[model samples]
Target: MSATLKWMWVLAVALATGCGKGATPLPTRLVPTRMPTIAPSPTSTEPGSADSGWVVAARGIEVRNLAVAGVVPDTAAPIYAVRLDPALVRLRVRYAPDTPQLLRTWVAAHHPLVAINGGFFTADNQATALIVADGEAHGASYAGFGGMLAASADGRVWIQALREEPYDPAVRLDQAIQSFPMLVYPGGVVAEISDNGQRARRTAVAMDRAGRLLIIVCPTSAFSLQALATWLASSDLEIDRALNFDGGSSSGLFVDVGDVRWQIDSFTTLPSVLLIEPRTS
Candidate 1:
C-alpha cells in the first residue's frame, strides 16, 4: 500500500472518541509513528524527560513539555503546549474545507505565530461542528452538548462547555469552533467525564484564569479523554476551561516564536486550524 493509504489506516485507529453524545465514532488507541525528520532550532531548548519549566518562546508566548503518567497500556505520554497571552496575540479560526492542508502547509501560507488542528470533521473533510470564519458561518453547533472556543468582535476569547452554557446566536464572533466533552472547568476543576477505556493521541484548547490561550497536544496514543481532563485540572497549568479537539492522526501544532520553533505534524491533513498572530492595537 502507498504511504498515504497506510497513514489513513493508522489515522482511523487514532481518532479516539466516546464522549457520549455527538462524539465522533472511530476506533481508539493510536499507534505512534516516527515524527518527520527536522533539525531543532538553534534557540530550541529541547524538553527532556522531566518537565522543562515553561520557557519564554517569544514575547507573550511560552512553551513547555510534560511527561504524562502511564495509562493501562503505555508507560508515559509526551505532552507539548504553547501558552499565548491574548493581550499580546489574537486568534483566528481559519476554515478551508475545500483546500485543507497539513499544519506545515498552513504555516507556509499564513506564517502565523502559532497554529494547531481544530475540531472534528467528516471523512470528506467538512467540519463536524460549527465553524465561523471571517464572520461567515459554516457547519452547525453541537446543540446542548459539546463545547466551543470562540473569539468575538469585541476582542474577547473564551472557552465554554455547551451543556453548561449554550452558544448565544446573537453574539457576533470572528472565529469559533465546537468540539466534544468539556475538559477542565472554571477554577481548575476537572469536568466530570465517563472514561471510555480507549486511548489515542489527543489535542485540546484551553484558557487560564489570566485568560491566556493554550494549544496542547499529546504526541503519543496513550491517553483517554477522561484521563486528559483529569490531568489538565490537576496539572500546574492553571486551566480555567478547556475543550477536546479531533485527535490521533489529526492532531498537530506548529510554532515559530523567536529562536524557538517546532512543528508537530498531524498524521493526516486538517480541514481547519486556529491561527495566532501578534495583536495589533
Candidate 2:
C-alpha cells in the first residue's frame, strides 16, 4: 500500500475511536519520502537577539496593527483586528460609537432588542442588558466573580449581582459560558491570573461573535463607558462590541512572530494567562 494511504488509515482510526465533547478534529498525517530541512543562515547571530522585556513565540500568521489607538470623541471608528485562534476568520467592526451611552444608543437604534435606561445599558438581539430591555434588572450587578465568560442577548452572560465576598468557583449562574483568557479589551479588563494563582477579574471592552460592542468598567480607573466608546470610535481599525475586563498593574500585551516573540508592555508580575498574538500574515 502507498505511504499516504497508510497514514490516512491511522488517522481515521484515531478519530473513529475518539468521539466525545471537547475533542478538536485532527488533521490526517501524510507520509513523505524526503525529510524537510533548512540550513541556518550565516547571518543568524548568537543567542539573546531580543531584549529582556518581550518574547516572540508564534509564526506564519500575520501581525496586524495594534488593537487600541487614539480616536475621536464619539463616533464609530476602526481600531485593529483581533484574531480568534484556530479560526482565521476576522471580526470587523460592523458599527460602533463611543461611550457607553452612545454605544448603547447605537445598539438600541440598530439592534432589535436593545434599549436604554438610567445606566445606558443596551442589548443586542438576545434581549440581555441589565437596564436596556424592559423588565430587566436596572440595578443588576456582580461581585467577586470575575472574568467575561459569555455574552448573549439573554441572561447567560450576566446574573444577579451580589455583594463583594470571598472568591467562589462553585458559584453558578443560568447562562452558557465561553471563556477567552489573557485577552485585553478596550475599557481596561484583563482576563489573567493574580499573583497568587487566582482568577484575575478586570473589566474592559470586548467584542462578541456578532462583532457587537460591550463595556465592563469597574469602580477603579477613569473608566467612563461613554468616554471609552468615544475614544474607540476614533480608532483606525473597526470594532463591534468592546467589553472591559480588569486593569491596574496587571495590564500588558504580548507579540510573537515565529521564533521572534516579545512583550509590548511590561507588568510587575506575570498574569495567570496571557492573550497570545501569533504571527499575523
Candidate 3:
C-alpha cells in the first residue's frame, strides 16, 4: 500500500476503536509567543562538548563520551538532559509483546544512539494509549491520558496535551506515542498531582525552545509529580511542552555514543521503547 493510504487505513482503525472519548480538558492557558533562550553550549574544548549544555549546579556532571549532561536544579533533583537534533536523529517506537526487552537489549538490537522507556502499560505489557510505530497504529487512541509526543514525517517533534485535542491519524506522523499527566504545558507547569504526593524516580520527554528533543530522567527518589513540573517550568532548559511517562520502577535511559555506553536500567522490563537512531539519507 502507498504510505498515504496506509496512514488512512490506520486512521480508520483508530476511529473505529473509539479514538475520541473521555478526554480531560487541559487548562486554558496562554501560550508564550516568544521562545525562551537556551543556555550556551558547554565551554569544554572536548570532543562531545558540542552537544553538552553548561553545568547548572554544584553536583552537575558531564559524560563527555556519551554526550550527556547532568544538572541539579533548585528543585533538588538531578536531571540528565540529552539533546538530539532532528536532522541527525530519527525517532521510532520498538515493542515486543511476547518477549519484552530491556533498554539495553533494545539499544543493542536497533543500534540507536539513545533509548528511553515509552508510555504506561498493563501487567500483560500492553500499551495503554495510542501508539503509532513507523506509520502503523498499534492501538486505539486513548482519551484518558492527557499528553502525546508525535514525530512528523520530516522528523520534527511535537508535544501536546491530548486532553486538549485527540490524536488525528490523518495527520502525517511517522511515530505517535501517548502518555499521562502532562508535566508542563506550553505556558507553564500544569501537572495533575496525586493526593498521596509521594516522591519517586521520574522520566519525561520534552521539546526545548530551540526545537531539540530532550529525554529527561530523574534518578533521585526526591521529586513528586508536582515538584517535577515546577522544576521543569522554572529551569533553564526552556522546555515548551513536557509529558510524563511511566516512571518510578519503569524509568530508564540508555545511550551508546561512540565507544561509550551509559545506561540507567529499570527495575522491570518495559513493553515499549522510544529510540533515536541516525537518519539515513
Candidate 4:
C-alpha cells in the first residue's frame, strides 16, 4: 500500500482496538508543529505591540474587525489573542454530527465575522460536554470538564468554572459551549499543569473585564497547559475568566473583515465551532 493508505490502515486498527489494553486516557496537552513567523503590524497598540513581544495578526473595528494580537509571555511559547466585542457581534455554536467540516470550510459556509474551534470532543468528533446552540440544548451536561462559555439572549457573555457552580441549562442562556480545565477564573489561574510536561498548540475562549470575548490560539507546539494559563492570568489582557478548548492539530481561528481575511487553519476536522456574526437589529 502507499504510505498514506498504510498510515490510514494503522489509524483504523488503532481506533478499532481502542489503542489496546489501557483505560481510555483523558486528552493530554498538545505538542505543536513548527509554524511560520508572522510579522507584526505597525499600528498595533502598546502592550500588544511588536516591541512588546506581540505581533498584531489582524486589526479593525472591535466588532467588525477580526482583531488578533500575538504574544509570547515570559518563557512560554507564542500565543495569539483575538478580541471580539459582544455588543456588536452575535455568538453561536455550529455542529452537524454527520457533516463534520474543516475550520476553513465552516467559515466559508457560515460566513462568520470570526470563528474558532468550539470545544473538546470524543474520538468520533462528538462534543464532550453540554452543547446548547441557537438556544437549544443538544447534549446532556457532563462534568468531565468544568469550564464553560455561555451567552444570554441579551448579548451578554460570561465564563464560569462549574466546580464551584454547576451548569444550569434552565438559565436564560441563548448559547453555551463547554470545554475542559478552567484556565483562569475570577480569583486566579485554576489549571494544574501536569508534570508529564507535554506541550502542543493551545486554544482558549475567554471574556475580559469589559465583557468583550477573546479567542486565544497558539499555532506553535510550545506551551504546556499550566504555562498557558499562568501567562493568561498574569498578562495585561485583563481576562476575567478563560476556558481551554481542543488544541494541538485541532486548534484554529478564521476571520474575515472586508477585503482582508486572516486564517490559521487546523490540520484536523472539527465537529463544532463557535461562530461570530454581526448583530442583526
Per-residue lDDT tens digits for candidate 4, residues 116-203, read 8877665666665688888888765645445788889998888888877788755977889877667887765557744254555667
Residue pairs in candidate 1 whose N, alpha carbon or C atoms collide under 3 angstroms: none
Best by lDDT: 1
- Deviation from native of the Cα of residue 25 in model 1, angstroms: 9.6
Best by TM-score: 1
Ranking by TM-score: 1, 4, 3, 2
Query: What TM-score does structure 3 among the candidates reach?
Result: 0.72
Q: For residues 1-281, could you state the per-residue lDDT of candidate 2 as single tens digits?
A: 89557534533332222111122322222111111111122212212122122111222122232212222223222111223322322111121112322222333334311111111111221111122222222222233332233323332232111222322334443222221122333333332322222112123444544443333322112223344444444433243334332232222233223443322221122212222222233
Q: Model 1, which residues run further than 4 Å from truth?
A: 1-48, 72-74
* Model with the higher lDDT, candidate 1 or 2: 1
Residue-level lDDT for 184 in candidate 3: 87
lDDT computed for candidate 1 = 0.75
Error of 1 at 251 (Å): 0.0
Query: What lDDT score goes with residue 26 in model 3?
Result: 20
lDDT (C-alpha, whole model) for all candidates: 0.75, 0.26, 0.62, 0.64
